[model samples]
Target: MLIVITSEEFVEDEINIIKRLLKEGLTTLHVRKPFFSSEEMKRWLFNFHAEEHQQMMLHQHHFLAEDFQLKGIHLKEEHRKSIKGKEQDFLEKIKSQGWVLSTSFHELQEVENQTLFDYAFLSPVFTSISKHNYEGKKFSVQQNKRPVIALGGIKTENIEKAYQLGYQGVAVLGCVWHQENVITSFKNIKKEYKRVYQ
Candidate 1:
């Protein structure tokens, strides 16, 4: 799957771009607005069509996931660390509710050890395009047991390389949101991914 994550801070016309992305076949959209209050997040979510709501994964106010009928809930790396012991019960409840579970990882070992999540993100596979001085480590997914989506600095040019490295999917943030034409950038990345994977 080709996933697109929202920037931490909302960008201009982000909703429009996201709608267009869903219209253009973007299957997953991770809503990662850490600074947005639950009420603020609700108002922002209301901007989308009800049908579009299912395509999103919330990074905060997970209670909203069920309310919005969102696809899933995402745990930021820090959030995951904070709830170390309660993860099992949390995962069971979320899974029982049919919400897809996902989280982030900076290390390959963490990805391998976590099999309960439907998928997870392993980032910085390439030099980051949106975050300054955040270098890429090119983490390999060869040993991962669950689906591992490569994140950070993913672009059309290196998509094939990500596939070759054994990533089950790729999550694009900077490569799409930072562009002047988000839809066009998304299409290019999707095209490149299909060319390489299909």
Candidate 2:
């Protein structure tokens, strides 16, 4: 459940770097290019192998996911609420197509409502480049019966703290994308995770 977020800012070579990382050991690759059009995502998916596509989850664009047969779809908190009362219906529809659902949660109440998806991202577990000054934020994992992943500013150094706090795993963005060496960064973080949890 080690999730790595893909960035639109990644250079062409960076895509290859990520592909290599995926081959090496990364578990989940979240295609979170908020700026990418559905056409662009489709093009990117077409370029990758089926194994890569199978491990990838789109950030939004449920229709595109269905069209491509992606593993699942993730929504931001705002997007999650827009379809609020119809969550069960929506989940059933997506589930029927063999797609899982995931969303973000900034509060305890959101985590408590576990009907939407298989997991929720409870973020800013540590100060992160993607989120600044997140230390003051509350990270309540007690309300979740389903798996809850810690996101936001997570890095290799603080992953143990995140797991101790009851997160299933950490979802990373800039820490991996903005690194000087993406593969090494991912391997280091992943190794630490395995060492600690093992």
Candidate 3:
């Protein structure tokens, strides 16, 4: 699987590029704008056709999942800790509704210990393209045993590397948004994902 993340700052014509990718068979999109309010997310997603809603996984304002019938809810560290008091109850609730659950991790050991998620993201497998001077962790994805998605500094050139290293999938941030031609860039990543894993 290949996943795409929204840039923290809006890029020009971002939604239209995303729409084109959906037509080209984009499956999962992680809407991770930490600055956006639920209303802002709703207003922005309103621009898309309703059929596309199932592909979106919101990183904030997860309640919007019910309103939009989105793919699922993604939790950060803070959100995950907040529900720790009633983790079982929360899990049951999401399961009853058939919502997908995902989270992010910076360390590979943490991923091995965690069993609550459908998939987890372990990032900085390479130096971050958008974050200044944040070096890569360089952990071997081949050692990972869970459904882990590699994030950070992933581009078409190195997508096959990620797969060979044993990642079930990859999530793109900088490679997709920072490019001059976003559609072509995403298409190339998708193409490479198929080449390596299919």
Candidate 4:
């Protein structure tokens, strides 16, 4: 799966750009707008076709996931820590309801967890294109039992490398949202992913 993340800052014509991405086979879209209120998030989601909500993965206002029939919920590091004891009940309920649950990990060692999440993000596999000085972790992802999608600095050139490192998927943010032509960039990345894995 190729996941695309929303820019922290909403850009003009974002809906159009996302529409094109979905058309180009984006399996998931991570809506990680820390600054957006629940109402703002709702409004932003409404701008897309109602069916598009099925592909959305939310980072906040997780209540909105059920409310909007989103694909799943993503837990940021702090949010994941907050729900430490309740993780089981939360995962059980979400699983019963058929929601995908995922989280992020900065350290590869932390990825060895008991709870089964559908996927997790292990980032900075390459020097970041969007975040300056956030160099690549260069960690081999072979040990993850849970599906781990490579994140951070992922682009067409290195996406294949990530898959070779044993990542089940790749998440792209800076490469798509910060590019001069977002749609073309997405198409090219998707092409590269298929070339490497298919």
Error of 1 at 119 (Å): 0.8
Summarize candidate 4's per-residue lDDT along 1-198 as a digit string, tens digits: 889989998698888888878877887999999999999988888887767889999998998888889999998889877888888887788987789988988888877663557889887888888899999987787876778889988989898789889999899999988989999898899899999878
For every candidate, C-alpha RMSD to the true structure in Å? 1.3, 1.8, 1.2, 1.2
Full-model lDDT for every candidate? 0.88, 0.78, 0.87, 0.87
Model 1 steric clash pairs: none
Ranking by TM-score: 4, 3, 1, 2
Candidate 2's C-alpha runs over 4 A off are 133-138
- At residue 5, candidate 4 shows an lDDT of 89
Question: What shift in Å separates residue 171 of candidate 2 from its native position after superposition?
Answer: 0.6
CA deviation > 4 Å runs, candidate 3 = none
lDDT: worst 10-residue window of model 1 = 9-18
| Per-candidate count of clashing residue pairs (backbone under 3 Å) | 0, 1, 0, 0
Instruction: Give TM-scores for every candidate, taking all chains together and pairing residue i with residue i.
Output: 0.95, 0.91, 0.96, 0.96
Task: Give the CA lDDT, 0 to 100, for residue 186 in model 4.
Answer: 89
In angstroms, how far off is 52's CA in candidate 4?
A: 0.6
lDDT by residue for model 1 (59-140), tens: 9999999888999999887778787899789778997888998988887777889876789988788989989987888988
Better of 2 and 3 by TM-score: 3
- What is the Cα-based lDDT of residue 70 in candidate 4? 91
Which whole-number lDDT from 0 to 100 does residue 129 have in model 4?
A: 85
